[model samples]
Target: MKRTIDFILAAAGLLVLALPVCIIYVLVRWKLGSPAFFRQTRPGLHGKPFELVKFRSMTDEVHKLDSERITPFGQFLRSTSLDEIPQLWNVLKGDMSLIGPRPLLMSYLPLYTPEQMRRHNVRPGISGWAQVNGRCAVSWEEKFRLDIWYVDNQSFWLDVKIFFLTIKKVLIRQNVVGVDVNGIPFTGTSAESSSGK
Candidate 1:
């Protein structure tokens, strides 16, 4: 039932947003150059790997700082979350859900504790409980806590609530890029104490 809802809504969303997505793609190409889409492997449901797609908001300039590689236009895409529009296709392709814990880098898979690994029980999402609550602004520990809470409590109604909250957060542009993009990576035990795991 949830999968049905995810597919229906994702397909509809992709259709409705098609023009805007195209426009964004063109703009990204003009600003960031060729290969306007960013593709990377991320852990999906059950910690399986899948290619997560987004607009390429950063430049390919090597030997530069992350801040330097990120152009102004890229910053705008990240702030408005326009970069994530491509993930609707991921949802349509059954690699993701319309609402679930946001997928993290595949490299982080081994760093997750047994409890934290439970987040992969459902399909990953473009937006989620952690996203609406604080997104990158929160500590890794706090984000994991929210993710686990959603894992335990997820339902159709809860997904609906998160959907709207995500819209509100994005419109308000709150907590977007509030944390350092190059902050230290997560370790398995880093957040374990907070969750009492």
Candidate 2:
């Protein structure tokens, strides 16, 4: 049932945003040169890997940090979440759901404690409980807690709630952090940050 909804909505989204997606693609290409899509392997359901795609919001400056590489247009994309429009394809591809725990880097797999690891029990999402709650504004530990909470409490109604909240957050542009500025790398389990509960 959830998969059905994800597929239907994702398909509709791609169709509805087709023109805008193309415009963003062309703009990204003009502004950032080739490879307008940013693709990365993210852990999906049950820790499986899938390529997550978004618009290229940063310059191809290998020597510079992500924070330094982000362009003004990229910041606009991030603030408006236009960069994520391409990820509807991921949902259509069965790599993601409409609502679930947002996928994290595969490198962070080993860093998660047993409790925190439970987030991968379901498919990753473009928007999740943590995203609407605090996004990058909250601590990584707290984000994990929210993720786990969603993992445990997820339902049709919950997804419905999150879907709307996500719209509101994106419109208001709340809690978004600059690239690599506030999203601290998770090292491993610690007394202060390990518990996902």
Which candidate leads the pack in lDDT?
2
* Tens-place lDDT digits, model 2, residues 51-165: 9999989998999988899999998999898998888999999999988888888998988888899999999998889888877777777778888999999999999999999
Q: Please give the range of 10 consecutive residues that has the lowest summed lDDT in model 1.
A: 174-183
Q: What's the CA RMSD for each of the models?
A: 2.3, 2.1
lDDT of each residue in 14-87, candidate 1, tens digit only: 99999999999889889889999999898899999999888988899979977799998898888788888899
Whole-structure CA lDDT of model 1? 0.83
**TM-scores for the candidates:** 0.92, 0.94
> What's the lDDT for candidate 2?
0.86
- What is the alpha-carbon RMSD of candidate 1 to the true structure? 2.3
Tell me the deviation in Å of residue 55 in model 2. 0.4
